[model samples]
Every structure is written in C-alpha cells, then in structure tokens.
Target: MQLTVFFDPKFLAIMSNRLQNKKSHKILFLDNTLDVGGQEKLLYDFLSRIDRGRFDAVICCLKRGGYLKDAFKKLGFGFYEELLSHKYDALAYRKVSRILAKEKVDLIHSFIHPNTVFFSHMAMLTRSVKAWVLAIHASGSPAGGRLIGRFQKLFLSRVSRYVALADAHKRYLVDVEGLPEKKIDVINNGVDVDKFHPGPSDPDFKKGLGISEGEQVVTTVASLNRRKRIDLLLQSASIVLEKRRHVRFLIVGGGPERNRLEHLTRYFGIEKNVTFTGIRDDTPAILRASDLFVLASMRGTETFPLVLLEAMASGLPVVSTDVGSVRELVVDGESAIVVPPENAEALAQAIEILLTNEEKARVFGMKGREVAVERFTLDQMSIRMERLYEHVLSRSRRAD
Candidate 1:
C-alpha cells in the first residue's frame, strides 16, 4: 500500500507567505462615471466597509465623478476625474498613464464595459499595474449604448479575473460572454443590515410623501429606466387600484425614463394612486415607511439588484418579477412573492395577495429580514472582497 499526495509547490509557498505578509496593495477602481446608481452605491458601500489596514482604494472616473465623488473623498480614499474628450483620446490615455505611474497602482478593478476597455489600454501604457479585475454589475453586455460595446469581446483578454454578482450571472458571463468559468468569481451583493432594518415608520415622512393614514403603501425602489419597466408597474398599479384603492404605490429613484414613465402613469390614469419620489438620499426611511415592496424589472436589465436587499433588510414584504438573480436572495413564496416578468396582471395579483393578507405580509417581512441579516450583510461582503484582493495579488506575484 502506498499513500501519495500531490500539491503544487507554488500554491504551498504562496499560502505560507500570505500568512506572514501584511503589505497593503493599492487598487484603482475605474468607472465611466460615479453617477448616483446601484453599482456606484455598491462600490461606495464596499469601499466604506473594506479593511483599511489590508488594502488601499482609489477611484478614477473616465468622465465626471458625479455626486458620489465627494462622498468617496470623505472616506479618506483618493479620487480622480480623468476626462476623455471622445472614445479614443490620445491625450486622456497619456494622462491616465501618468496617473497609473504616479499612483503606482498594484491592481486595476473596473466596472462596466467601457471602463474595462479603458483599463486594457492603460495596462499597455504602464507597467506599474500588476493585475486587473472586471466586475459585470449588469446582466447583459453592450449596456449604456456606447460604441465600445461593439468591441468589448476583443478587449476582455486583459482582465485578470471577472466578478459576477450571483451564480446565474456567472453562467451568463461564461456562456454568453465567453469568459472562462474558472476565472469568474461569484460574490453576491450585500447590504448594511444595521443601517437598513425594521423600524417604526415616521409619520412626518409618510405625510411628506402624501401618504395618508390607514393606507397600505406598496413601494418600488429602482432607477426609472425603460428596462426597469416603470410602465409595467404603473399598469399594474391601475389594476390594483381598481380593487384596493387604499393602496398607494410609491415609485422611488429617478433616471431618464421619468418623463416617459410619468406619461405612462397618466395614460394608465393612476396618477393619484402613484407617487414618483425621484432620486432621494433617504431610501432607508422610504423603505421603512412601506407596507410592501415591489420590483417590476424586465429580464436582462438587473443582476442581483441591491434595492431588493435594502427592501428585505427594511423588513418589507417584496412582490417582484422573477428576473436576474432575485431567486437567489428570496424564496418564491416564503420570503417574498415572485411573479413573471412583463406581466402586469400577474404582478398586480402578487401585490394584491400581499396587501390583502396582512398577517401573511408580516410573516414574509420577518423571514426576509432574517435572510438579509444572516446571509447578506456588509461585514460578510467586505471580508470576501478583502480575501479576493489577496488572492489576485498573490497570483500576480507568482506569475512574476
């Protein structure tokens, strides 16, 4: 009899050295802009909770840094705005190369496809960057209607690793985007449980939003984009209002689709029953004030929405269309009600079920809160990201 164990010496050496080394690596996160959206906010929340002692983070926006730049700076992280006059700007490329050389960035992590392409070009200009990671926050590629969308397949080679928000999202990357399965890491998006928890709804907050007493509130927090299907929600609201007039639908967040969605709301003749709150900083408060949360998004537009986690964390029963990786977060019937996407009748029926049955909705909310706290918390996500950084840096070192 013989017992033999085979292990790569390089892996053992890397593991042994990682235990003794605590050197911090500087990471440059590149994005098209720091707009007030879920992806931007996710990056902010992760950065705020990331292990400051283990890693350093810098944000470089190819265009403007948008509103979140100042918020990022308040966290003591470096932020830069490198404007690109066009898609292919030689001067901007040179400027970004200087930034890479001066900052001595150890790794480059980019969000969206355009920024990934920008990172690929900069990698060729500077030898200081050792590794780069691409995070596909959305479900499909060629998002945001950019010219670079046509050429992303040619530029993905420079990415050291790819991050998918959920298992289904990972499959899409591997099957549709042709990314290698081994190189893709599934890191589920997490929410701050402490910040968004079950709490008493403020009367003034409800009153300010025109929510009357004894009225059941059904809220949906999503960017008012066409893919979000705000129109579908409004159409569903019309049906729900026909039955439950006491139910008020609160449409939170804003985007380019506001005007068109508002027109659709008017078209559905549910303007009085629905209130578009636009983009607000007080999402936690809004979620707390709601009796039920609804998300009516079309397929391929969402990839594990952060708003769903916020709703669950706030202890609100969710009635969402089955899209993206939503099923990964909530059980179809236990934690929340899942319905078919793009179906107003089914969406309306799901909302009515939760709204009409008070006890069921309460139980659903409790279970959802449990799920959010136990599985998806800021601490859990931050620790996983820290380990990922270590793994990428170690591999980059071994390759050298």
Candidate 2:
C-alpha cells in the first residue's frame, strides 16, 4: 500500500493548529472487524508491503478485532480495536473524530458496509482528514434492508471517492445506488503469485484430509455462508460423485451455515466423499494440493473474489457461477468453465468435463496461471491503488 497521502495546502495553512509539519501524511484504514476474512487479509497484505517512506498507516476496528490482531501487530502497524460499541454510539464517533484530529490523518480508506457508513459520517464531522475512500467488496443491500441501505447511501454520498473492485460493480453502484459514476474506481483484486503457484500435489496433505490416493480433489475456499452457496456446491458434488466416484470435495472455511451444509452433505448421502476443513491458514499449500477449484456463489453477491485470484495463481482450472466480475477475471472457456448460479446440473457438468479431460484441465490451469501473473499481481494492484489515492488527494486539494 503506497500511502500517497495528499492534502490541500490551503487547509494545511488555515488549520495550522491541527496539521503537523511532517514529511509523511498519516492515513487511517478503517474496517468493521479484524476477522479472518478476505477484506482483512487484503488489508494485511497491503500493509505488509506498504511504502513507509511516503506515508504513515494505522488501522482502527470499529467493532471487534479478532484473529488478525496479533498478525497486524507483528507487522508494526498501529492497531486500535473496539472503537465503536453499538450502532448509535455518539461518544464513540466523537472518540474516532478526536483520534483523526490528533493523528492529523490525511486520508481515511474504509472497507465494506457498516464501517464505510461510519467513516462517511465521520468524514462529515472531522476536518483533519482530507479524503474519504470507501471500497465496496460485495453487492446487494447494506445488510439491514432498504432503510439501512438508504441511510448508508445517504452518508456515503459525501465521501471523497469510491473503489469498486470490478466494472460490473461500478455500474451497479451508479445505476442501482445512484452514486456518482466518475467517483468510482474499478480496481480488480490481486494475489501474491509467489505464494500461490503450480506445485506438486502433497500426498501427505491429501491423506490427512481423508482423501485417498489417486482421488482427484475439487476445492472451494469460502466462508460457509448462504450467499457463498456452499449447499449448492454440495448438491453438485453429489451429482458429480454419482458418476465419478474417485473424487474428493473439500469445503474450506467456517461460518453460520456450517451445520446446515454438513447436514445437506449427509442428506445427499455423499458424506464420505466430502470434508469440511473449517478455516485453515495454509491456503497456498491447500490450493497446491488440489486438482481443481470451484466457486458457487449466488448471483449479485460476490464481487471480484480474491480467492479466485489465489486459485488462478495456484494454476488450478476453475468452475465458478457467473456472478460479480468473474468474467473479467477468467475467460469463460480458456481459464474456467462459467456456470449460472444455483444451477447444480451446470456446475456438475462443468466439474465433470474438467475432471474427465486431464489435458484440457491442464491447459486451463496453465492459462489461469498466465492470467494471474500477467494481470492480477499484488504489485500491479498496489501501484494502481497508490495512484488512486494520489488522485483523490489531489482532487481534495482542488475542492478545498
């Protein structure tokens, strides 16, 4: 993450008391939580590679900071947790504003829904911050319903700029949510290719997961949530197993929908062929030990999933529901077999097609790895993001 914190010279001159005479402009990265999720991991990766000479970076979790707290701490970035206790926490907002003022933060880059809403309101309340950027990682309502969605949009209308992970999502924000089209930047998700690449399948790892030798592995790494549609994947897995018995399905990650998904696997009478690994830190290793990757997310939910980038980086042929910016990520027939969401037959057919044809699957995997390297590397994403931050900062200067 290149901090590239820019502020208006006039504001700096007028607010001399609050503004500091420092070489590096401070930035505050806000999020709802520090849970082991894609957003948090993305932030971690950005911070790990941040250009410290250009700007100072800090993170504040509005709610709870779970799992990744120590990881962030080890990276030497300042981390704050439990800044907001409830929805209507006026004092907490004031505290956050004070922190912004004291830090002399030049920018506030917030992620996802509730945190974006909170920071949007905070941007209105504080003068210390120059730019407010909110990245929309998913589509649909803002979680509570039309009422909350309206409130969120109303608050975010005043933000400095918006980061949409895909052009499809950028259109949705302008068309459905009535946000300014020019304010949205479509920056695709990226992965660390060095960490995830073509490698030999680990026989020991497969055996530990109850996968027998010579059994092909089809894996999906996602939170076991309804929007992720892990149940639909299980249904397709059942169909695939009826014809292809020498295959193992690994449903990675844990969420509220775990028990129901497990029950569904049993209901399909394919319990022996499926394994739920809950959550694991060794995702790169797991990806290397798999034959294929699949994502059955529901329509209008996911947007430029980082897991897909990871899978592509790992040189695995993909089978994904045509949702969000999947088309932008992988060529339909070259790198992956795109299928409609909630269609088990299509998913099963695509899975079977890839598994049956080793040469085709290998070619797809090779193409996916090529795309990952050529288009979606961490350095490429960071450079683009740095430029956006600079643009937003420069625009803020002109506006002031």
Candidate 3:
C-alpha cells in the first residue's frame, strides 16, 4: 500500500522495494456523490468498464449513492458509500485516511472540487501514496459567472493533473487555471451507446404519461436547475405551439428548480402542453419516445452533456444552445441545431425545423448516431482510461 500526495508528472524517485511489473495496481476514486448528472454517469461508467485484470478499483463516494453504485457492485466492483459526515466534515479526513491504509490504495482519483484538496492534503501528509488525479466536471467551474470564478480557479490549481471533460475544459485549465498543457487530458464524456440507444418504449411510457399517438412530444432529461434553463424550454415550447398545434413537452428530471419551472409553464400559458415527470431512470426509453430532444443550457456549465450523446444514440436530433463543447459534437445542420442560450425565438425555430422536416431530421439523427457509436462509446472511453492507469502505475513503480 503506497499513499502519496498531489500527482507529479516528472516523478522519478529512488526506493527500496521489490516491485513487480505486471501486478494489477489498486486505485481509489473519491467522488463527491453518486447523483445522476452527466459527470456522475461518466465516473460510474468508468468504474464499471475499466479493465479489471490490469487494475483493482474501489470507489468511495461522499454521499447520496444512486442505483448505479449498486449496479457497479452487482458487476463485482468494490464501493464505499456515504463516508463523509457532511459537505465540510472534519471527521471525513480521518475516516478517509483509515480507508486508504486499510485498502492499500496505490493512487487516488478525485472527482469534483474540494475532494481534490482534501485527498491531496491527506496524501501529502501521509507520504504513502503515488499520485492524486483530479477529474474536472464543467459545472464545478463558474458558470454562474461571478465570485464563483475565483473559488473555482483556486480549487483547480491544487490537483496533480486535471482530467478535463472536453477540449474547452483543457483550454480553461491552461488559460484560466494556469495548468501546464501536458498536465491536462481532454477525455470527453461518453455514454454506453448499447444501453442508451433507441429502445421500444416500455409499452407503458405513453400510457403512463397520457401521451396520445398523434402528439408531437419533445423530451429534455436534465436536472431541474437554473443552468438547464427550464424557463427557456417553456418559452420555446410556447413558440413551437404557434406553428404546430397539440405539441406536448415531456420534462424527465427533478431538482430545486422544478416548482419554479412548473410555475413558468403556467405563466407562459403552455402548462397544458407540458408534463413534468420528475427524476426518472427510463431515460433511453423516454428519449426514444420523443419526436425531438432539446437541451437549453448556458455555455460554461454544459460541456459535453451525456444526455446529448444519449439523445443522438437514441436517434433523436438535438437542439441545444451553443455552449461549452456543444459545437464540438452538434454541427449546426448536420447533427443538430445549435442556438444561442436564452433565445426563445431561436430555440423554437431550430426545434421547428427538425420537427417540420422528417427526412432531414432522420438524416441528422442517423449521422449523430454514427458519431456517437464511433467516437463516444463507453468501451472507447474505458480503453483510453485503462491505458492511462497502466501508464500511471508503471510510472509510480519507476518513481520508487
């Protein structure tokens, strides 16, 4: 068991140990929680698919372990749930130190903010580890656009290496966070295309939601939050109804903003056309049942959303704001329409184009699916990460 501090790329040390070259190294990943966000999905998917023969993995989540944690365990992976007492728990430090010693962790991967600081602090003091790797989720930065930027930048600089979600993230690491280019890797968030691809709606989706056969349904599956801009969704849906009557909206997630968003729908007089299904596990089927998929988010927070890839894999053309790395995946006309965030008129018009032209929509959906299958597959992400782990472990041994 080797416990270490923040990662060092150029590390080469003299040591006294009989280290084998091919033994599977153990890794510990500390994620803030197991919520159903795109970043959480990326972390969980990596935990599930990484090569077990080359690496032994254990995940210790701070709190709120979702169904995916159990799903990981079902696949024979080890997990430690709800170890943190609270968001700023002092006891968490001691508890994590014990787990590190007991598990004999070789490397620590920190996902989200503060966890990097906490883990790096522990590892530096303990002097028993090899490296600390930080996974930078886009939302962890200052999409809110104010004092949060200062905090985000401070937190980013404390890590060993930054694993970015997209190329935009890597750029921010270099320009904003001042991290070296070699210290950042832009590993785009990937989905399990086989699982997220088009599926027959559970035979009950329409029945449960009272969606009739001839209704034009559009679904957006994201946390009900300010960044998601559910109000913009409702505003656009109102515009969509002017061109085509009887268009229905299906919102398939819940959060703090659900009540406000619901009120906004009524305020816009399109309450009758919208249905808030709350948080749901049947995302692929819900997306499959939709005539179109939309994601209306501001730029900084929504870099490479997993739902966009899922929508593409489900053969649905997307209409999203040109935010973050969205332009990297969604071509203006080829894959999906890219609109400016908060522009109700543009959003509505883009969605209407896809809805009105079935032939073009089908072509875009097919092209998006091809991109998802070829570039954003879970297997490809796992393979890249497996090689990363092998490299990390090999370097760790050489440093000894």
Candidate 4:
C-alpha cells in the first residue's frame, strides 16, 4: 500500500511566510480622530480606493470614537481605537509599539496635529515600522495658532516623509516652520468625479426645500463657524435679494454658529429668501440644485477646500474669499470669482456678476468641471499615493 504524506506544520508555516513576503505591503493609517471633516473625508476617500492588490490597509485613531467610525468600518478595514487617555499618556506609547509589532505593519501614515507627533516618535523609537509619512492638510497658523505651529515644526523632522494638501501649505511649512522645501510633497485634495458629475437638479429636493423652479439658487456647504464667516454670506444674500428678488440662498451645514446666523437672517429681513438645510448627506445633489457656490471664510484655516472641487464637479461656478490656497485652485476670472475676505460688498458684487450673466456662469462652470476631472479625481490622488508608497518602500529596502 502506498502512503501519502501531508506537509509538516512547520513547513506549511514557512511556505505561508514565503507567500506573504511576495504579497501586498501592509499599511497602517493613524489619525487624531475620524470626525466628518475635510481631512477625515480625504482619508476615507484614499483608503476606500487604494489598490488592495498592492496594499493592505488598516486604520487606528488616537481618540476612541468619532462620527465617521461607522463609515470607516463599513469600508471593510481593520480598525483600532483609543491608544491614549490624555495628551502625555505613556501607556499610548506602549500600545502603539505593541500594535506595530503584532500587525507586522510595513508603513505608518499619520495625519493632523498630535497624532503626527505621537506616531512619528513611536515609529522612530520602536524601529518596527519601515516607513513613516506625515500628512498636513491645513496651514499651521490657523490650525491652532503659533503655539501648535511650533510643536509641529519641532517634531516634523523625525518622520521619514511629509505630505501637504496644497502648495500654499507646503510654503507655510518651509517659510514659517523652517522645514526644507524639498522634503515636502504637495498632493491636492481630490473627489470622486464619477459620483459628483454634473446632473439635473433633483426636483424632489428643490420642492422639499421650498425652492421654486425659476428662482436662482446660491448655495454654500460649510460648517457655520465664525472662521467660516457665514454671517458675511447672509449679509451678501440680503444684498443680492434687494437687486434680484427671484434668488434663493441655501446654507447646507450645522455648527455652533447656527443660532447666530439664523438671527442674522432675520435681522436682514430676508428670512424667506434663505433656507438652512442643516448637515445634509446629499451634498452632491445640493450642488446640482445650485447656480453658484460661495465660501466667505475669514481665516487661513482652509488649505484646499474639498467643497470647492465638489461644486466644480457638479458644474456650479464658485465665488469665494481669498483664503488659504483658494486662488491656486480658482483662476481670477475663469473658474471662480475671488474676493477679499470679510468684505460683504465685494462678495455680493461677485455673486451678482455670476447671477446676472448666464453665459459667463456657464463657461466658468464648464471650465471648472474640466479642471477638476483633469487634476482632482480620486483615481489621480490614489495613483500618486501608490507611487509615494512604492518610493518610500524602495528607499527603505536599499538602506537595509
């Protein structure tokens, strides 16, 4: 009788290791939180579309939970939570070190403030991770003023690589933080062009919001915060209504400034012309239903506003304040009208220029759409990230 022999368990383990060595690189993303902000959304978009055949993705947060936690879970990623209790908690260092060792993570990419400092330090101390990439999405001055800026500058040199969301932000790091310009990589924020393409306004959405068919819709999708300067949007809306009574203003977000903004709407006596659709999930649809998109931010908090790209993808012309990297995104008289920040009269005039000139508005919208599809698609961003990962991994292997 012939006896068949199965492979030994030790042999099988060795074979498995060999196969895994030929497999995709494992990447871990560490963020301060999973909240529904620009940075969090960008992380989601990048992770969701990254080529799984080339990179295995995992996510962890310094804080335990956030609004986007469920959304991230739904994307079928491995997730860890709450590595720290307080800012200086030593237990976090141990936890991070243990996680890196256990997962056999090849690379770690961290975003935003303290998370960047913490993860970069851990990667250096443990030497467990092969490469560390830090992503900074906003200008440091408005992120938390000069104090937080100092901390970032001090810790940034410890990481293996750096990413900035805009050229303006890259300049900020070099000019204000004293970092070498060559070390930073500028990756502009991108959107899903296929999902946010130009479409007919949803008739049901318009009706539900009490917007009539013939009225011009001017909309802004931003958190109603003082820095956002939404009050200026309302003041401008009032000015637009006096000249064009057929126009309607749609404000699409919720924040602490909601009550004050509502009061301003009443104070201007144009309550019927404005409707605040608080915290909508259907932002793409809202953009389709609008004639113009406006953002009157009063601070340097925005590096590259993702909403501007979304508005362009939806075929809506933009009118925004000259803040952060907005001018880099929008040409002065082509894709958008850029006005000085905090000037209600200038903001109103810009809005009226687009409101009255349909041909100019159409041309601007079309050009914006073209620019977004060419430079800011999700696929383009993912491809750039893949290149970055490969480059860093190649360098690490050479060093070893």
How many steric overlaps are in each model, in order? 0, 0, 5, 0
TM-score of each candidate structure, all chains considered together:
0.90, 0.90, 0.88, 0.91
- Tens digits of lDDT, candidate 4, 1-51: 999999866446546766788567888888777876777877888887777
lDDT of 1 at 181: 98
lDDT (10s digit) by residue, model 2, range 1-400: 6778888653455356335543565788887778877778888887877656555788888887788888888987677888776766756877777778777788988865665576656675566688888887877642422322665665775677889888887887787777899888988878999999999967888788878988999999998888888989999999999999999999899899999998998899999999999899989989998999999998766778899999999999999999878999999999999999889999999999999999999999999999999999988888888888888888888989
- Candidate 2 Cα outliers beyond 4 Å, as residue runs: 1-22, 141-148, 398-400
Model 2: lDDT of residue 221: 96
Residue-by-residue lDDT tens digits, candidate 1, 353-377: 9998999999999999999999998
What is the TM-score (0 to 1) of candidate 3? 0.88
After TM-score superposition, the amount by which residue 259's alpha carbon in candidate 2 deviates from its true location, in angstroms, is 1.4
Prediction 2 global C-alpha lDDT = 0.84
Minimal lDDT window, size 10, model 2: 141-150
Model 1 ranges with Cα > 4 A deviation: 1-22, 141-150
lDDT (0 to 1) per candidate: 0.83, 0.84, 0.76, 0.83
Question: lDDT of model 2 at residue 92?
Answer: 80
